[model samples]
Target: MNGNDQVSRCGYVAIVGRPNVGKSTLLNRILGQKISITSKKPQTTRHQVLGIHTEGATQAIYVDTPGIHLAQGDRNKAINRYMNDAATSALRDVDLVVFIVDRTKWTEEDELVFQRIEHLKVPVILALNKVDWLDDKAELLPFIQKLAARRDFAEVIPISAIQGDQVSVLEQAVAQRLPESIHYFPDDQVTDRSQRFLAAELVREKIMRSLGNELPYQTTVEIEQFKYQGKTLHIHALILVEREGQKKIIIGEKGERIRQIGRDARVDMQDAFESKVMLNLWVKVKRGWSDDDRALKSLGFDDLG
Candidate 1:
């Protein structure tokens, strides 16, 4: 075949791992833009985000999935179930799977992900993430050896998703394995998510990072209205909590807490949208909506699955 006719390589790639394993971070690094919202908190990404990368004729459609973890007690809520379902669903009918894990630590959740991928026929690449945090680089050899014994990975790559280390190598690895086909999306399009969805996610991310440990999981943001007027976007959002007390906590003593959340979210939204944002936020109590399937479906959680 001619060089121009032979360069085409396009396929689906799913990035899966336990919560806080830097799956979203790696996606942002690969695409070189923040389409998926991220926080230090586990389960920060509750939806399936599609990021597309094109180089020459290689077009890789990357699916950034929610971290899969063992669900129990309050963790057995519908939201968590949705996340697990979303992550698992991404694995089906994909040309490649990049299973991400931390540099030096492997938890039970990691094993859970391993079990899920064990039966998949697609090629699985084990990515040892967070190598930048390692104090002794020697530790990685044994870790890679140990993980390699668990499964027959197509390739094992060490990367620092935050530092952008070896990420291009990982991309090359992914691209080389993709089956040749036509580009699934336009070359310039970076992600499958729209600005409106990303705006809501940015708001949720601000709430997650701003509030202390407990509040993040108890909160979810819903975009009530998103409209563009001239050079500015007018956005109205609702911060949903399970109880009146939780709503009070989000609102803070003199509404300062919610104001800060709005401010932070607005700045990020402006950066993402590339325009001024007029954000209107309100705190509302939905009372156990997280555990209710119907409630979660209404809140747009079920669509991820």
Candidate 2:
């Protein structure tokens, strides 16, 4: 059949919820790849990452957004505001929204998410993630019943994104609702971001995983150079921090910690890109840059005001 005669499904799908609810994990599960970074820290995702999945006749472009949360306390920083706005913006012009939540765990931020999407005309599918960890499975039904009364959801699916449970069902549900249109991307393509962007994120992911409390949040990764020659790639990255003390924490005694971070990140980069990698890392202090809007824009967070 020709393009006009064949019925093809394609559209954007926004996955949103409060922090630490496994929004990024759900996206990685659906795509069967780690396109977005995940961490135990709330607000690990500072930008809206796009992951596209195509099956037989359906294409679902998933937008993995920063968790929507109440902006207060230390979370009231400029970067936090930028993350909130980016997540909110992903809701616009989408075919469907996958509202992910933790199983039987509802917080004030969940209520905030409800309020954000209450007036939207789009269809929402409530995904209760991490059901595998639920101690009492019998409570699932009652919880769904109570949540159902709060909003008119298209479907309420209980899933475990980390364990790869019921994610296919969620994928099928999203695919069925998408409109008939040509695919916006090639079928082989999985994400809208380039390798350089993903590389920087991978480095930052290592920073988040390695550092002690609060140190990672004060840091951002920037790729000074990335070049490929023959079968190997060379990368030079800088970790930007707000204070000299934070820089010292990252570098560690005798530069052991930063070296370990670079080693781990390079291994991950090799696996993700399927090539040998040479990663060089440096830590620098940019004093109070996270709060400075102009500085944030220079660091590639120009999407928000």
Candidate 3:
């Protein structure tokens, strides 16, 4: 049938998993673009990123969420609560849920995610991510069978989000389940986020990748200026940390580390914006911002439930 004669299908699909389970990678692979940032650290994704994929008559809007983790004692910060809420809230009305798990390893966090979605009326596809990293291919079927017995999943598919193995099959499975409806985004559109948000995210991604375990979680990026002059995109990002020590760590000796971060971020911005980028970065101390509710709200963390 011609394009005009076929019916369009569109729906929201939520990708949920524990920290560092390749949820962002899967979304980027499915959409063939990067909307969600990734790092080796847990909780790298702290917000709900929407990636839109339109193919022929099917458009799947994917919500890539933060890793749902337990918070207690020192970990029970306002930001942690925000992250958990953001992750769970994405499940409210989604048409389908792609529950990703690290290959053959189910932790308490994975069980927590399952508990949250167990009662949902929508179809849940259990995606076994990182299958390419598995040493023994013989373990696949038994692991699949073990998880499949947890509940009645619509489909239990093994996929390697990083290697693009079975990713197309996963996308096809998602497309088949989408409801018949008009596309919410244009065929050319890929994400619901703006360039300003993406610019800040790219900077944050660099920080996450550059720093050690603890510091990246203590930092966030804010764009002070984003404008176009001639053929260049100029951006000024403010990196906020909770202490002077943290600021110094990000800045590094003789400002070399921060400069490297800027250089990396600028390249990504240029590629994403398709324009020359004049990027500037600065680090500041915002004490207790990560734990203070008012500070978090002021820093644009108030969108979650």
Candidate 4:
């Protein structure tokens, strides 16, 4: 053992909520960097993106999974599987479940989140996010009362996740539940994903923000290469599309849209990598990629993987 190493407090924390509830946004804020893909559209996140945070003696491993929704096609089925796995897997040994929800209203999905994980036998903190959207206290009070009646979560804290209002309060609430275990990650570890994964996720977030529905669901970001030069980082990436039409749409008139996307994505990737990046971006068609087992597996979206 080192000369000075106290017994660490390490445990997992899963963020579960409905689609478009700003789950990815919350994780990115906590990490002070982007690890999960964020979009205004529903169902943008596809898998459990792990983010590691260490504070004093506590190490909270956050698992940001896809939104919980009813299953439909194979893609939807896969997303459901990912959400269930992320929530319950950590429930087995985790110290907390942050049941995130919108503050303005409570929906069936929110109820489902409580019902699904109520048996975890650990603390379930009902984090009422997006309070900034609520203009009146009366509008949020009933929702909080409803959540309290559920008897499903341990504590309900109102917070504006995007604006970061009362986030410190929520953090303190979560930290209070952590057991005195050893730290699972190093002190400086901000997230569990590598640089390449974060680069791809940045690209994906750019596509979702720039292209909207036209190409958001049909796309996947893959980092083909990441290398270091003297002062700049050399990177190669592929924007996987399922159709030729989507590719053309992404490229846009005279490749203007692609250039815009590249600029935006490169800026974010550079900030994430902390180096000037020479990014090479290419768009390719994978033909119904989300449903194709091989393509999904290749992109690390498979159930087994």
Cα lDDT for residue 176, candidate 3: 96
Candidate 1, residues 173-247, lDDT tens digits: the string is 999999979898998999988787898899899888878665648688888899999988999999898888888
Error of 4 at 214 (Å): 2.2
> All candidates: CA RMSD in angstroms?
1.5, 1.7, 1.3, 2.5
- The global C-alpha lDDT for each of the candidates, from Candidate 1 onward, is 0.89, 0.89, 0.91, 0.77
lDDT of 2 by residue, 1-305 (tens): 23555578899999999999999998988888889998888888999899999987789999999999888987788888889999999999999999988999889999898888887899999999998998898888998999888788999999999998989999989998999988899999999888999999998998888875855587898999999988889999999998888888899999999999999999989999999999899888898887888988898887632
| TM-score (C-alpha) between model 1 and the true structure | 0.96
* Stretches of candidate 3 exceeding 4 Å from the true structure: 1-4, 214-216
- Index of the highest-TM-score prediction: 3
Best by lDDT: 3
**Would you give me the overall lDDT of model 2?**
0.89
Per-residue lDDT of model 4, residues 1-305, tens digit only: 23357556777887888788888888888877778878788778877777887777767888787777655664464435554555445455567888888776667766666677766787888888888887786777777776677676678888877888888887778777777876778879887677887888777887888877675476888888998989899889999987888899888999998889889988987777788989888999887766565667788765422
lDDT of 4 at 166: 83
**By how many angstroms RMSD does model 3 differ from the true structure?**
1.3
Q: In model 1, where do residues sit more than 4 Å from their true spots?
A: 1-6
- The digit string of per-residue lDDT tens for model 3 on 60-122 reads 999999999989876699999999999999999899999999999989999999899988999
Q: List the residue pairs that clash in candidate 4.
A: 8-181
lDDT of 2 at 28: 89
